[model samples]
Target: MDLDVFVAAHRAEWERLDQLLRRRRHLTGAETDELVTLYQRTATHLSQVQASAPDPALTSRLTTLVARARSAVVGARKSTWRDAAHFFTAGFPAACYRTRYWWVPTGIVFTLLVAVIGWWIAGNPEVQGAIAAPEEVREMTREGGAYETYYTESPAAAFSAQVWTNNAQVAAISLAFGALLGIPVVWVLLMNAVNVGVGVGLMAAAGRLDVFMGLILPHGLLELTAVFVAAGVGLRLGWTVIDPGRRTRRAALAQEGRAAIGMAIGLAAVLFVSGLIEGFVTPSGLPTWGRITIGIVAEAAFLVYVFVVGRRAYLAGETGDIVEADRAAEAPVAA
Candidate 1:
């Protein structure tokens, strides 16, 4: 309890510990051992001072020193690069693979819906007239018309950024609104289907179906797939809210929410590729076959990334959630 005597007794040990910590990078085996011993002794002194005669400046200094020493002894975590590598290699892909059951149906149903709507618009003259003026439809579907100009109007870099931003926003909205029992997700998917259908129907009616496909396929293949993935995951999240199965509703939401977040990040990268294709390849002087082939290859690569790489990660027990150490402790559930 004698403050000055306590300080005088511990000052040398504290200084030695501080010195060892400072030279931690260059420490030898014997010096490392000494550092640990000193760290423990200094910690004890800090405790004694706290209980007996705590001083504001001394306490803060000791706290910082102890923290630094602990870090040195335990070693710091890996950098952001390792975290990112794991996410792309395992976490993101595994989540997508696991959730494929949800999104596969979404993609199929969306395709069917678009086809049906396209058929209706293309076949029905009244529907076509109701949708747009004949001149407008003709102008849009004409050679070197609105559809082609749309891709080329802006500089490639600016257009790529713009498309990426817009698609990312759509994906974010689907994931964010998923908690509302998925009603908004349904609306999002339907709206996308309708818009696509309208375009296709108008083009087909104008006898320019090839033009529509050529322009759209160069980017739409991957872009729409990413959107479908988001909508599907959102609906799945909403379903968890309605029926949590073995998990409590809160637990289900938490798990699904984490997966949704991972999907959002993964989808952003996917959308970026699609945006690049739309901005660059779609507008480039490449023939329609060449542009479409590029889009197909990108889309195929993504599927392989999801199914092949993701399946491996999923089998290895990676969930789409944060690593176990980062997650909150959950109570055991009955089997």
Candidate 2:
């Protein structure tokens, strides 16, 4: 076909592609193929026109087509409110629990965080030196660091606030960092574990272990558990590249990750509930017996969920199970 004739014939179709892509999704393969052909055809024509044709009219037409193509891509992106919510709720925790033996690695990371934090507080000369100072010196200053500052005041409020903030942070971090699927997720989970280990350890070493445990255990267990769930999502993403067992890395991660959706939302809900308890019920200086009871109850609930309820809730079942996983996995990529 003549260059000008082909360019003119495609002008209207390119504009239609841009408009149609912007307005709706789920385009049939034939329709999409047509759009792709229109784009490629226009691009080739523009290149030929630039190199050989000197017609002013053809140049203007090519410029217009280029704009339309860029616009079409923007129109193609699928950033809906539902996708984002689904990404957090369905994308993180479920993947974490589903990926085989996820907890084992998470536990190791958590323990290391705890030990590092504990050592920093108990042994390092700077910390030990401060703790050993006379009571009068302690009394004179109000500028305690994060750990110490929380120690002296209304621990209930501090602990409660920490639960809410940390839990939310874990969810956000998991979803955002899952894109790369590496240390960011691991580090986030490890950081939480370290915080928990050190925070609890300091209380014990200072002889306020009972008070700290009582205050923290009421909600900390739930909150931390949720955080681990988020980390699992990231782990799922990373394993796609690292292990990729069988069907290409992309294909495997996509499948396993898809199956993990429910758990992510469930974890977010757990974080929310944990925040509520920490805010309303847990308080610093609660009696030892009371703290123990709270810890026992919280731990019991977590165990129950992990062993019994979690299995049922996190797993796909009945109806839409396999189909839904495929849809969730493809939805983002399709966009």
Candidate 3:
């Protein structure tokens, strides 16, 4: 109730708290402890002042001091634009580069499967008939037909968003379900390969393989790569469940799972870029070579980013996991 006496009693403590806050980044352990204690006391004082004396200026000063001390004690872990930048530049690429062994082979295998399927379907009338009536197949593969018009069917912006959402979902599923022994991921990749193969087969049989290549390559190169990345990461996650090496299974899964989640986010952006190309460039008036060139450039840039930027970051000890300060504390285990 005696405001003057209270101010005199706590003035030194308030100043000390302020000083510690000003030097928070350089605080010794003892000083950090002192700051926490002072913060608690100052918060209590502010509460008492508000409920009792209600001194305008003193209450205001204590409120500000207490707020600063709370930040110092509790820390500000809110992510900012800087975190996003680091993830794209270092975390995402590092993850892709680190897991290249899994995904690179996945892409190769998937491509080969697609090619074999296409060859089988294009060469065999029975296989072609099994897919659809010959007439329907012919219609779909005809010039300016279903395959060519599919990209232009919707408004470009709407199509882009739709494509992005669909691809992002596929990528998310691949990454999220990897823990289920990666069976789902394999199935996903198979289904995608079949779909692409059907297109290739139909177009090749119709003597319009060029049309299919032109339409698909503009976005397929990057889009398929993203899917492969997700599938590979998912498979790795499944394998981690089987053989955790030096780490406990739980620890290894937790670490890889975090990186997979980050990859999901980063891959969403990658798919978005491909969606833009698919929606706009693929369907635009650009020459086929021009569209294909754009797609190749985008894919190449992504590879370079992974190998150059990502490799550098990984070598510098980045693991695509959350920074140590943000990671959950684990109980120490004997090696």
Best by TM-score: 3
Give the poorly placed runs of model 2, Cα more than 4 Å off.
1-97, 127-162, 197-201, 256-262, 284-286, 312-322, 325-335
CA lDDT of each prediction against the hidden true structure? 0.86, 0.57, 0.92
Return the candidate ranking by lDDT, descending. Answer: 3, 1, 2
RMSD of each: 9.3, 9.6, 10.9
Model 3 Cα lDDT, one tens digit per residue, 1-335: 89999999999999999999998999889998898888878887886776568789997898788767766776878999999999999999999999999999999999999999999999998999999998898789998789988999999999999999999999999999999999999999999999999999889999999989999998999999999999999999999999988766767899999999999999999999999999999999999999999999999999999999999999999999999866533434457
- Lowest lDDT sum, 10 consecutive residues, model 1, at 325-334
Error of 3 at 256 (Å): 0.8
* lDDT for model 2: 0.57
Cα error, candidate 2, residue 138 (Å): 4.1
Q: Estimate each model's TM-score.
A: 0.77, 0.55, 0.79
Q: What TM-score number comes out for model 2?
A: 0.55
158 in model 3: Cα distance from truth in Å? Answer: 0.9
lDDT of 3 at 3: 90
